[model samples]
Target chain A: MLEFIDANCRLGRGPAPREGAPNTTEEILALMDRFQVRSAVVYHASAQYAEIMASNRRLKEETRGSDRFFMQWAVLPPVWDLFPDPEALLDEMKQNGVNSVRMFPAQFGHSMKRYAAGALLDTLAAHRVPVFLPFDQIGNWDALYELCETYPDVRFVLCSPGYRCLRWLVPIMDRCPNLYVETSNFLMHNGFRLFCANMGADRLVFGSGMPEASLAAAASQLLLSDISQTEKEQIAGGNILRLLSEVAL
Target chain B: MIGENVLRGEPFKGVFIFDIHAHIDATSDFELTDSSPDKVVRTLDALGIGGACVSSILSIHADCPLGNLHVKEACSKYPGRLYGYLTVSPYDPDTDLDGAFADPHFKGMKVHAAFHRTAINDPRYEPYWEYADKKRLPVLFHAWELADVRHIAELAPRYPDAKFIIGHGAMRTWEIKREVVKAVKHNGNIFADTTVSVAYDGAIEWAASQLGADRVCYGSDIPFYDCRHVVGKVATSRLSDADKEKILGENAKKILDLP
Candidate 1:
């Protein structure tokens, strides 16, 4: 059996709860056990719907004792101390064992351009900390391209690009070497095979998009893809592990 | 266990697997490297599925006539391994659904009223619905909302013979899913297809609990979503082995009247 480290998961009690999704740590652990997942990198749903910093704190508290959960913080620009300065934020993240960060530029109504978010982007790039961005929140392919191109050193993992993104995704991926794609909702037919053929297996990472998505569904894509076993291994967990290990913060 | 086979990346040994919703040929929207009949069959082979009912992307998005021809060719090439869903354009009055269904390989009909910018219960669709009713064929509709579910409920009794499979399970929202369940609960002919790209955890189990396993059939929306992905979801669901078997293939088999 292949071990899995779910790279994209949202953990928190959101306003509207769906049937069968785990919001509590115990439930999540049980689900992980059921799916044969070794661990997961999770950000709280409150980060998307409520106070960002408090949600990060809540996430830290929720996952504090478990080695199975890796914390990912939701961040914003440090304008008027809306968020901590980049250096201080990174320091706090290092202290809390938060290795990766997530940004919601479109949702938060902030520009991802250099003028608005340059300090934070520069700091993340300098530390080589992996950044997780939902593809829908990136606004458009051109915006994603600009964000990635402007900060080439910052590793951007695009989550849930969807099946229809290939027409736009390919060209951006061709230009942005720093861009990686999460495989949970990247559901195009023969997507894994085509992506590997075009971008190599290293650029793809396994993500369950759990709580709202099926863990088994995400795993089976790579498991049943017409690719070499080594390639499958890389996507199932290897690529994510490599990216996380490279996060100096 | 069925899930064990999926976890081991092996095909189901004893269970029959049939996909009720699938597509052939590439869509103009995205890149599908090998969506041809050969590739779809190879994918089914990888997952140990016996067959799939497919509609051409061309039929839904562009030229319906040319797309139906594509389906005919694919069904002919693969025989029992592939089944055709004859798609007709509501805008084009000259749709020869009767001629299209002359081929024995064409098992059902597919309608994307949502894509065609027409209501599923619109008068234009009535002729096709009547044709499907007369033949007692399974009509798969691209249903994604509460209105579509309501339309299916309204039309189901009138066309008592035609089996109505609500494509994507009316999956736009959880509330919509509830609406679909309520609307289709009393109708024997109306069924739900588990074809959404986002497969919500426990959604299938919940559906089976409410609608019964027989009312829910496995529809991968394949070539749009991988067959293995949806198959693994059903296999690993919290549903009973019998329920999983039914949803994965048994239910689809009964609906499509496949052997």
Candidate 2:
């Protein structure tokens, strides 16, 4: 079976609940390589003050001579506030061939504002790119599902749905076709089985939230799982490829 | 907590668990960071640990004071499960013949010296050896690397009068450090438990090749680790079932003087 497309991977946490070892771009890629992962739509930690730009710049720098890797949406509070026009950054990202966005509510502690964060959403909607919302492990489903339903066109990537309330994730995604999940944290036991049963392999991807976990171990959760080979391939890499291809990132 | 590798994925009578350590205080607040005597039991049960060797809470070396009483209560109440050990602070006298010391519920003494800043070889603690020597109650020490083989070598010679166990098996680096064997030099009165890293039968084999098989005993440093995982490792080790049986069930019984 395909190991799984770990859609939810991270880099640059110097220390726990913070950024350290697996926090650097190189460390993260090495982690991904351990499990033989091909590419990831990247996001920077909340430290860089618009770390999304840092994430974008790094992806560009790393992929300058390569084609497999790409960038997602990452933004720091400062750089976002200083933007002359939000659309300009969006256009610049598009021109630079960036693909998606990653949202961090736990770090910022609230939903992206409609007017302040709203304009950015408008730009993404205009471009039809996806936004990955990582609630720092304690996600706000109400806000995320609302974003997915409201935007309809924006693809929202949710990482680490976790194990506590299994039903909580599946039902939320029911109303939002654009919402997807990344299997990164606590992927063992029953959650992987539940995801394939409900979210379907097409909507699921692999991720290791590494340094705290092993890519081979996490990927093995899916690779070793009893899912169909075709579905496994799609979850492993095809889905992300499809999503990235649509956005031209 | 224990799972039989012989029965892995085949599914049987449910997970047969034996938690080798715990301190429950169920009345205390329930949080993952710390433990209370009652909460310890519930946590063990919650984690599918069928049985445990619980220590008391609140004492000088102070480990857990009431965990044994609680485990006795649990054992009487639950049956075929739960083992309790009383706290005996080397800082405070073991009070061997006292009601708490002689209480039938407890099988042994959970003596923690390092955490409470007492020496394993201190003469002040000799009362415990004297008492254990008389009654044959095995004493479990909070041993790490404080005493090298030379020190254990010294202590074992002096404490030939009592039954003793080095807690955490010298923090399981017995092979890496050889602190356990270097100390005992085949002193039959002293035994170590595999509660941490190096307790594997691999260590047992190396020890046997050098010191022989009877030196080490198996213990699941439960609550601190996934007991099922640890037991699975032990039960499925390359060691023979006789060795497995000793580590899994018999050695502990012999050490604690359990009927």
Candidate 3:
């Protein structure tokens, strides 16, 4: 059996009503076991809608003793006074052992453009921390294109981009090497093969969107793809592991 | 156990997979990784799908007659591996649709209201539905929203004999999918296909629970979507082994009347 390190996952209850039972850390661990996931990069589901600091603390508390889980913090606009400053935020993240950051600009009532996220992006870029954002909620591709072009240092991993959005993503990826796409909803037919052929497999990372999406459904795409086993291993966990390991903290 | 085997690329030691929805021929609008009949067959083989009910993209997106000819030829070439779904265009003038149905390769009908720019409950489709009911043929519709479910609700009881399979399981929103489950529950002839859905956690299991495993059929929406992902969705769903077997192939075989 192939060992998996799921790049995208959440713990705790989400803001919206979800089918099935409530999602607790235990439930997530059980699900990980069921799907043969050895480790996962996790964030609190409440972080998408709740106070970022409180949610981050909640995530820390829940995952305190677990070695199988890594934390990704939800960040807010610096103007909100949620934290001291971008530098302090990075310091706090480093102290908390957070290797990555996730931004829910739309849910948090802000734009992801340079005007709103400039300082945060600069800090993250300098720190070499990867940030996860949902492509659909980012308003438009042009904004992402501009961000990638402007910030050549920070690694941006767009999460849950639909297969239809490839036309826009392909050009952005071609133009920007720092940009990456998560594999949870990137369901184009032979998308992994074509992506690896055109852009290189290093630009793609494995993400299950587990507890909200099917782990089997998300991972099966790469497993059954016509790509080589080495490439599959990279997209499955290698690329994200490399990104996390390189985080300057 | 079968799900594990499917993930590991071992032979699926369960019911044979019958993809109820798939497309063939060249697609001009969007890129298809594999569009030819041979490629489609290879994909099915790779994913352990025993057979597929396929329609021509040309028929759905362009000319029905030309597409039907291609479909017939592909089915003829593959025989039992490929079953034809006669694509009916509301725009094109009727062209021996009944005669086309007489072909042994053609087993069902496929209609895309969104592609044809026609309403599902339009009077023109009445004759087609009538024919399907008479022949006990299944009709697959590309349903995506609540209104599509409403249209199915209106037409399904009217043509009770024809098995109406809702394509994509009305996969726009969770609320709409819930309505689809309810629609299938109330209407006996209405069925849902597990293809290219939103992959919401427990969506397949919820559908199976509400409508029973026999009402949900496996569909890959192949060439546009990956068959492995679709199969994994059903195989890993929180349903019983018997239910998973029924959804993966048994139900599709019964719906398409395949041996």
Q: Write the per-residue lDDT of candidate 2 for residues B73-131, one digit (tens) a residue.
A: 75556454566666666545545346755556566667666666756666776676677
lDDT of 1 at B157: 91
Q: Sum up the clashes in candidate 2.
A: 41
lDDT of 2: 0.55
lDDT of 2 by residue, A1-249 (tens): 243345655444433331222445665666455445677655444332344455556656653444545655564223435543656667777777767776665665544656446766766767768777654623566666666766776677787664333445667778778878776643323344446775677787666555443353355445534456777678778887788778743
Order the numbered candidates by lDDT, best leading. 1, 3, 2
lDDT of 1 at A224: 69
Candidate 2's docking class is: incorrect
Tens-digit lDDT track of model 1 for B164-235: 999988344887788788867878899998888567677778788878898888889888777778888888
lDDT score, residue B48, model 2?
45
Report lDDT (Cα) of residue B212, candidate 1. 88
- DockQ rank order: 1, 3, 2
Superior candidate under lDDT, 1 versus 2: 1
lDDT of 2 at B54: 66
Per-residue lDDT of candidate 3, residues A34-114 (tens digit) = 767789999987777666778887887877588998899888667767555888888888888888999887778886667
The 10 consecutive residues of candidate 1 chain A with the worst lDDT sum are A16-25
**DockQ values per model:** 0.70, 0.05, 0.50
TM-score of each: 0.97, 0.51, 0.94
Please list the residue runs of candidate 2 whose C-alpha ends up more than 4 Å from where it truly belongs after superposition: A1-4, A12-24, A46-55, A62-67, A76-81, A109-113, A137-139, A186-188, B1-259
Displacement of the residue B145 alpha carbon in candidate 3, Å: 0.8
Worst 10 residues of 2 chain A by lDDT: A12-21
